[model samples]
Target: MATGTVEHVKFRNRDMYWDIAADLHFPPGFDESKTYPAIVVAHPIGSCKEQTSGNVYAPALAEAGNVVIAFDASFQGASGGEPRFLEDPAQRVQDFSRVVDYLVTLPYVDADRIGVLGICGGGGYTLAAAKTEKRFKVVASVTGANFGRLQREMAGQNGGVIQALSTIGQQRTAEARGEQSAVNGFLPETAEAAKQTGDIDIIEAFEYYRTDRGQAEHGCVLFEAAHGTAVLGWDAFYLAEELLDQPLLIVIGDKDKQGAFGAYRDGHEIYERAASADKTLLEIDGASHYDLYDRPNGAGEALKTIVPFFNDKL
Candidate 1:
């Protein structure tokens, strides 16, 4: 059993409603005098912290005897930002750094031992954050995707990117004219509809977000279409080989084949590109991409590797 308390907390440039809404998990015992390592868990893009990081990853890391924080990014979930679902890769990276900054002020935290764990797009953002943020001593990602690149690849699939970009351009034009940005859903409203789209990623994502399996009533798939262009300029591995000298670990599942993910282990290129000789690439057998997110068995196996990696490196 985990021995810690969880609390809903928020802090930012200083406001409650617009702050980074988060959950703080403390280690197994109460000790105000002792300093402890801290970890930050970033949720997938288009996902709220409550689903993945706040509930699953953060608790696991906290179970391993460290403080953990899981937070919603700007313009999503409980957090507040204008033009909701504005997935600015650069801003998301900044969110990670700011979280670290907040942690630095905590008297009980050992700032030097701080670490970060990001899931999916959050994983990419985490990599971007670690690029220049020296405060994160170590970094790890689960089922990490370079969302910017992923967006481009998805948009470009079937030669739709050009059209998508045109639409994005129009939205930008509307915004410049002080018109409300166009809002649209990125996922189907139901699992069946998503499956009918013949897009495997959409099908799986819908299962997680639109159904009872992983759905959060307050969750959203509607985002500003204009933001899609922002992803075109981002890469998860940005400066990774040169600046990511700190230890790194990437965990992913291996069952996908012929689907959008294919059978390739996640973050393979990242591992190859990272300059850190100490980096590790772990792939859980018999698990698909979504499995790594919350499958009880897969999550257990992932922790076997994750808990040890952070304990040793951090």
Candidate 2:
């Protein structure tokens, strides 16, 4: 049987204590024979360790002769935080770095050969973290979204400025009156209500993230009031040109409709621009955006490329 442990651990930042929802997995054959490489897995936005596919990927990699630590982001999952679901890109990057800090302290981990896997929004955070965190010897991002671009579009789309303002204003009003403003969940319980909004991917996202398949009640979207605090002048794609002199791998679904029609072009262009000579990109045909998470070939295709990349790099 595989060995695992869950604990409430705190990492220091300046002087404040940052609590983490941390899980350490030890494969059946795990032994203290020698130091083994370890990888940190980050879940998607609005997702916890149990909500997203991290639960599958983390242990899979750990079983492949690498120790894996899958943890909930600071404000989400079972982690401690106030005004739940608040997402900060800078802080999220720090979370990955902090996880590395935790891993290095273990006698079983090889601190020199560390790697990280970030899925979806977590992928973007992985890239962002790698930009400065040299501890990550290898970085792999799956179906990553550029957070800054997402925020900019949300603030500038058709009537976006007004819509964002109105939404945030309404949420703040409720909060000021000592009310817990309702936030967005994965689904609305019915297909008709799911289609009311133009978020094309929500239909499928709701099917998985809201149903028993991938559902986790803790993974709720924040209200607009929390948007300002979470997004605050943040952008994930600031420096796509920097070279880390390490291996890099990126995976995206060729059929991801959430990024507009045939949006795989953006991911391809990123792979082309990466300065790492050891960099590789895989575009899976006939796969949807959400398919990369829990779909049949999703985790398989991802591990097929990711494990080897980490093996070669770390």
Candidate 3:
């Protein structure tokens, strides 16, 4: 059950669709006159605010006496934008900044003490936002998704991801001529099919997005095949440590699956690369990349560490 009041909201970003829909999680027993710290929580890539991060993180953080807000990425979930399910990292990172702009307006929020927290791809985007948007004084990421790894591989940089460029090129042409059907499905349609892919990451994604365990209607995000083209040039880790000056905290499971592509990217790499003098990396024993999303032991265990990180640092 939710521990606080939730207000459905609409805000704006500079994109073609300016209205961004979001859920603001007010603190339990919130006092309008009293100032409180604030945190902007972001959902993973291809996910809406109601998924694990946006659904669970806000309430837990709000109950800890801070105001938290989770919003859908533009063009995905409830946010307004064209090219639905478009996965543009650059614009997604800016969403956090716009959220910060709104948070600073609340009478009860301490703008100077604001922090940021993101899960999976949101974590990666949150880091990108922090690099340039200094409004976020502290930063924390759980199960950071390095989706761009696939982007790099497809560009032939990884070498192991052979001929991905050609495959993507074919799909891109189909997409350019408005062949939406040829490049729409982003995930396996069913758990059984996901399991048949012989990919552990897809199997785990199926465990959450395709089942009663953690499924949400908006979590099933589809995208254009041309999406991979943009990703191929972007690097989530580029100049990360030098560009990010904020105190950073990254947490992930020790047992996160290492597939050719997936959430298996290391949190320690970001922690090590971060320029912050005050950075920490937390590893949960026996937890996987998907486990950090939730599994009773996952989300619950993560908050035990996350809450304190915010309290002490923010």
Candidate 4:
């Protein structure tokens, strides 16, 4: 596989440890005199920088005259975090912001022109980062999820907010009493089952991430079944207004039913409602959730819109 320069890097804050592994891509005939804009590509949950989605998106952004840095989230992939397998939405957002901090220190990067692109859960993180960090001048969320909505549905009507909290409390109590907390969240494992979600992209996601097309790098995410942290955790909507001052781009596949693109619709609405006058939403017809991962046409469609979005805003 073709690769970029793998930099073993560290970014520190008193409260957290970030073991950042990034592949920096600068196109051929790179120039040092000019400072390039940057796109920090965030991997989906349970994913690493090597996944095809990240692989394609980062390089594509680089090829389009921007610098790209794709890195793993703190707890998963080759990144560092304790109590392994613990995933928190708030921390994930912080991870993205920290990446911005790291990027600003680089001489070749135009700190004022930084942007972020998140796929799947990464998309949500991208929104969260934009909401919280003023440094991200432009932000994009691809086939994303609204974790709050996801939690509400997963908990079910019978298990309301109180019930959900109670259940997680019980699990934590059990863990405190020497019992191990079991992780329960997972994507459909089979192609047929994935298709049954009424999402063609989900089925394709099953084919790519579950198979060799993207599987060699990392395993799928472990569902937080007991606590449903995605819901109980921080809400991106809480910080939505902060992003109003910046440019935002949201890309969704019309056929994506796996919730990535669907979630983008909500995010787009939020951005539209924001006072920021520089936001654009593009919905690609016939594209599914997985299509944006690596296929030339799908990725092509995304870049066609994305390159121009960044070009105008960045």
- Cα lDDT listed for each candidate: 0.80, 0.71, 0.79, 0.71
Q: What TM-score does candidate 3 reach?
A: 0.90
RMSD of 3: 2.6
lDDT of 1 by residue, 58-149 (tens): 88899888889998898888887887888888778888887887888889899999999998778878888888998999999888888777
lDDT of 3 by residue, 1-314 (tens): 24578889998744445788888888777888998899999998778899876678888898998888988888788888766777888778778888888888889899999999999888888887899889999998888876677556535555534466567788778867887634466578877788898776678877877778777888865765555556666777789868888988888877775754444455767777889998888888888777788765777888998998898888
lDDT of 4 by residue, 161-212 (tens): 6787888888878887998767764668677788888655455667877887
lDDT of 2 at 8: 38
Preferred candidate (lDDT higher): 1 or 2:
1
- The lDDT, on a scale of 0 to 1, for candidate 4 is 0.71
> What does the lDDT read for residue 208 in candidate 1?
82
Candidate 2 per-residue C-alpha lDDT over 262-302 given as tens digits, one digit per residue, 9 for 90 to 100? 22544565577666678888888777667778776766777
Question: What's the ranking of the predictions by TM-score, best on top?
Answer: 1, 3, 4, 2
- For model 3, what is the alpha-carbon lDDT of residue 230? 61
Best by TM-score: 1
Could you tell me the TM-score of candidate 4? Answer: 0.87
Q: For every model shown, what is its TM-score relative to the native structure?
A: 0.92, 0.86, 0.90, 0.87
Report clash pairs, candidate 4. Answer: 143-260, 144-260, 185-223, 201-289
Candidate 2 ranges with C-alpha deviation above 4 Å? 1-15, 155-159, 162-189, 195-200, 227-232, 243-245, 257-266
lDDT of candidate 4 at residue 307, scale 0 to 100: 80
